[model samples]
Target: MKIERIYLLFYGISFISAHVNAFDPITTTLAVGIGATLGSIFKYFQEHCSSKWISFNSTGLEVDLENKLFGQHIASRIISKAVNGFMNNDNPKKPLVLSLHGWTGTGKNFVSKMIAENIYKEGMHSSFVHVFTSELHFPHASQIEIYKSQLQQWIKGNVTNCAQSMFIFDEMDKMHPGLIDSIKPYLDYYDKLDGVSYRKAIFIFLSNAGGESIIQTALDFWKAGRDREEIGLSDVETALSLSVFNNKKSGLWHTSLIDKNLVDFFVPFLPLEYKHVVQCALAEMEARDLEPDMSIADQVARDLIYFPKSERVFSVTGCKTIISKLDYYV
Candidate 1:
């Protein structure tokens, strides 16, 4: 009888221990579910709050444009107009089209990047921002047809998904002929066809087609002892447009986008001078977490080759070579 009572006591203790040690499956599941729910709510708020802030603020964008190397006025004006237009309730019903033309290293790509950075929170990495390079994306002339179809579908699909899309075409001077025309439809006016509206989208083209003309104009101003700042859009507008239209190698040479006056701005990026090269060097140095050194910057600028063998007034390679030159100096 005492053994039986001891066994009953041991069994009771064991049962109590099991209840204390093991968690209730339903309660544990509820705890895990609550944690997951809290995490999702936090993520949702984080994304929405950030997006709201970016969509409303333009100060960051304005400052970025002002800090760019060159084409300050034109870039700022056109970009502001585009951004404001996008933000405004009553604005034009067309896509903001900008064609950035200049020699290499003259800030065409830089300006594009700045615009992307300020306009979109994700910048060039944004899912809404699509970049197509001629050499890398559409190299083969024979594949132009396939490229055209793909480009159209891609644009349509993305725009349908999100109207605030940005498309950037780089190395446009190397793009195949008749391929850019595929996008002409999207750029043109359309009154909600198939429930797709592309007016809110932005298109940017970067090309070297008018590089020579721009250099010549700047050179003439320099020879005439005119201030480089005096060189206005009016001075190069006609010549630059004509050059691009006439050049067979240019992607927009025979395209309707040019002929139809669909291109809103033909922003010219002038070649960088010695001072600009120094600035670029300093900027690059600063970017690398290095202190800015005038001596190193000056040496780097002097090492660059300038144009007009006799005059040598401007850097032939512009800021394009500044980074490489800094590698040696710094």
Candidate 2:
């Protein structure tokens, strides 16, 4: 038997829309019975897969969600700052931990997970994973609706920024103010918040706002005046990196909107130190002796990631860098 296709609906809730079936009563009854059974099976498969998101590649790094929480955190200098900051903050609410990275950088996705994993391992309900950006409640109305309402109220409170956090909004700089406002409760904050793990929760809002956008907007206007001028004598750079296109040139995209205040909201939580961590991680790999067997990109990646107590120190971004950087190390 050939199976044509599989459609999985995780939410399970189905909206059946039917006008009186044009079929006779016996045929209509049969159709209804088949539809209900098919729908339930689809939802079950979707739910089964929804339980995990793993990052595995032949290149060496394996990031499993389970290992991250059960193991102690791995820190680079940037992570060290967060850990130290976490320990020192006696304030009832936790500091909002935010991180920003342009395209080509998976740091937002990578870093935020580590932070939440830390919170959960510290005795927080494993179910609290519900609060993460990749929540399993995706298509669920009741769980998602209730979570959003609580988060909205929490955002309005002016406690620590880590009060029930939001996600790693990909290209937030391109979003409209109206759209920003819709998620305002998730991004901006007021005072006197509660239930947030001021000691644990963090809002990691990543963006290319000031660095990429402002630079391009300025370049666009500068280039306009120079089109009539001769080349090489030009004071402005006319070319753009593909990374820049992936990271910055999203203003025209209807879906790429970010709150203008996102940076300000997250600046306080930004990592204070990364240079030493980057340097140390590099050193750890250099000491490995096996680094000579890899490429430059892999070498760079090797130095970039921190090995958790339960897992290896390889990651997707670092994997490419490892291959590229291998030559230098060898």
Candidate 3:
């Protein structure tokens, strides 16, 4: 009876040791007969690591918006709405869709980066954050079908694994027409469909299709002697939407996504004035741990090309080139 009891104890220890060894090598037999305890320890560590991996801090995002991004009130408000939607547990029924429309260097990508940074531990580098650029990922019109399949599969797989994933489609104005429509099903209003729920996901489209209209409106406001801050979403929402829809080259053009009002917000990135450019220069300098000088910022801002040779309205490229130009001053 004593020998049989010893055998049973040995067998149990062997079994537990094997499982523990799969995770980490046992340095001592002190772990023997404590399989349940060891398993709990392993689980705790796993949970700790996972908890450290995914982090979303709303306060951090607000601070970034105030400091990093400048002259983008409408865009900021729309982004806040999207972030709030993601964080809200009550309204998890539909994905937050944002159509970021503006010219290049006007903070579309910047705002996307800010959102990713605040929402994910890895930020823009997060595996769950997928960015597809028209110029880089899907340039050829013939490859639209392939791109559509890949995009759908990618979204489905990631959302299945983690519903809080984010998809950023950049340069939509340059994407192949009708290609973006493949995502309509996921963006549609459904409680649950096709055995998957994409309600917790977020989709952001960055495009320059309606950029001209946005800039023109802002310019018009400037000419009318109105404070640039007075320009609101109500001022440009209709024109911007119509421009993006009517423009044949726009990826959203003739697509049900826009017509059906699947898009939650048409966040316009307004053209940056020289003062905004100066602010960007100062911010960039501060980012590099250098004390910023207004004289240097003024010089950098002055070098940037502005629109309407007559009025010299605003920075044509916004703050896109501010960092590069700062190298000369620093």
Q: Whole-model lDDT for model 3 versus the true structure?
A: 0.85
Off by over 4 Å in 1: 1-56, 71-77, 85-91
Where is model 1 poorest over a 10-residue stretch in terms of lDDT?
Answer: 47-56
lDDT of 1 by residue, 1-330 (tens): 755754565565455445552457765555556556555645554422135423524777677666655534554666667666665643458888999988888887887787777767777777778999999999999989999999999999988877777899999999987899999989988856678888878899999999899889888988899987888889888999999988999998888998988898888878878788888888899899999999999999888888876766777777888877788877
Q: Model 2: per-residue lDDT, tens digit, 1-330?
A: 112332322222133224435756765665576577777756554422111421112111224322221111222233445544544465523334444433223234445555545444321233333333322322243454554565455444423432333334444344322232333433334333244333334455444443343234333443466421122212121222222224433321222223233322222111111232343344446556555223443345446544232344223232224333544665
Model 3 earns a TM-score of 0.84
Candidate 3: minimum summed lDDT over ten consecutive residues — where? 42-51
lDDT of 1: 0.79
lDDT, candidates in the order shown: 0.79, 0.36, 0.85
TM-score of every prediction relative to native: 0.84, 0.35, 0.84
Is 2 or 3 the stronger prediction by lDDT? 3
**1 or 2, which is superior by lDDT?**
1
Order by lDDT, highest first: 3, 1, 2
Q: Cα deviation of 190 in candidate 1 (Å)?
A: 1.6
Q: In model 3, which runs have C-alpha deviations exceeding 4 angstroms?
A: 1-52
